[model samples]
Target: MSVPVEVIFKRPEALRDRPTHYCPGCPHGIAHRLVAEALDDLGLRERAVGVAPVGCSVLAYNYFNCDFQEAAHGRAPALATGIKRGRPDTIVFTYQGDGDLASIGMAEIIHAANRGEKITVVFINNAIYGMTGGQMAPTTLVGQKTTTSPYGRDPEQIGWPIRMAELLSTLVAPVYVTRQALYTPQLVRKARKALHTAFRLQAEGKGFTFVELLSSCPTGWGMTPVEALEWGKEKMMAYFPLGEFKKPEAEEGGKK
Candidate 1:
């Protein structure tokens, strides 16, 4: 008698059935998977609409199975706001990088959070620009060298790195704001839970939700994959501590 085979694990339905173009040790893939898993688990894939801005995840549409739209550099929040407002039934989200979110799009994100738009945002922070030849980003750590900061980022010369999760949490409109990392398996699990919480809040029609993921960029950082993870755990994690900066209250979940 022939025995039936059992399937143990599989890819999330929210993800496309193809390979991603992310570089080795690049945490964008992990970020994508986490978002996809959350969407799949919540049965929100059909209602999902992603807006990806310029940066390493500029081509994010190609990786997700749900509807996706592209936005100009540093304009994802604006586009996502329009989408969510126009189609309130759909779950709108923005996938942005530090270069886009903390740089030119600062005003857009802050106003969006302050307005309490019912949308979810996934911010991948790798400290350096991953798509534009490894340039220094707004979240780049002090003393870190990049193409733009060839001699290393000097706090005195340039302003200090902006902590986005904390900044957004200070606003009254956002119901949820958290920072997490993907350097190790344990941290990745926590990051996954954070994503789930953000999406769940968004689905419940809660106010703005944001999840900042401290990711690794091996190619951009000019380090081996293993070395990049180690460096990120040591350097990035220390600067961007992981945990919830803000969360919803009992009454915060009542709005539709």
Candidate 2:
């Protein structure tokens, strides 16, 4: 008998044919897959609009099959808020990097959360800034060396890495917040589920939803793809714990 092929290997309809621009071993590709899968799961492909930020994954518009908009550096949240409010019927999502979200766009993100913008935010926290070379990002861990911090990040000089999920959870307006990783098959599955929940909240007209994905930048981290995966589990996971920080209420008032 011939071996049967599984349907799991097929690409999602929400993914376009354009070859990915991410560097070999870069986790951006994985993140894209998770987002596409979420859209597919929620049947939101046609009505979904994605905002791409100015970073290494700036060209995310090319990979996702849904409508896409380019936002100015660190302004994705503001742009996404406008898009979501203007087209309340559609599902709006913003893809941002650590540098874009935790740095220059910090105010926008916090205020959007405060207002409970009904949009989904896919935050890719890869520690270092990948687009303009491997510089220290706001999420870079202490003792982690980047181009801008050859001596490693110091809490006294640079302060500690920002925990976006925790910070967003403090805001009362957000309906959902979670941190997930894409380093392994199990973790990837969890990340997909988290992404799906975020989009679901958007579809339900719930408040803001944020999913911080701990990803790797192999080229920037100066490690091979395999090494980077190991490093993410050993180093990144310690700082950014993976779990749901908040969730929508149940019909009876309990946590959903």
Number of the top-ranking candidate, with TM-score as the measure? 1
Candidate with the greatest lDDT versus the true structure:
2
Residues 133-176, candidate 2: write the lDDT tens digits. 99999999999999999998999997999999999998889989
lDDT of 2 at 103: 97
RMSD of 1: 2.5
Candidates in order, TM-scores: namely 0.96, 0.95
Task: Put down candidate 1 lDDT per residue, 69-166, tens digits, no spaces.
Answer: 99999889999999999999999999999999999899999999999999999999999898889999999999999999999999999989999999
RMSD of each: 2.5, 2.2
**Model 2 clashing residue pairs (backbone):** none
Worst 10 residues of 1 by lDDT: 247-256
TM-score of 1: 0.96
**lDDT score, candidate 1:** 0.91
State the displacement of the C-alpha of residue 33, model 2, in Å, after optimal TM-score superposition: 0.8
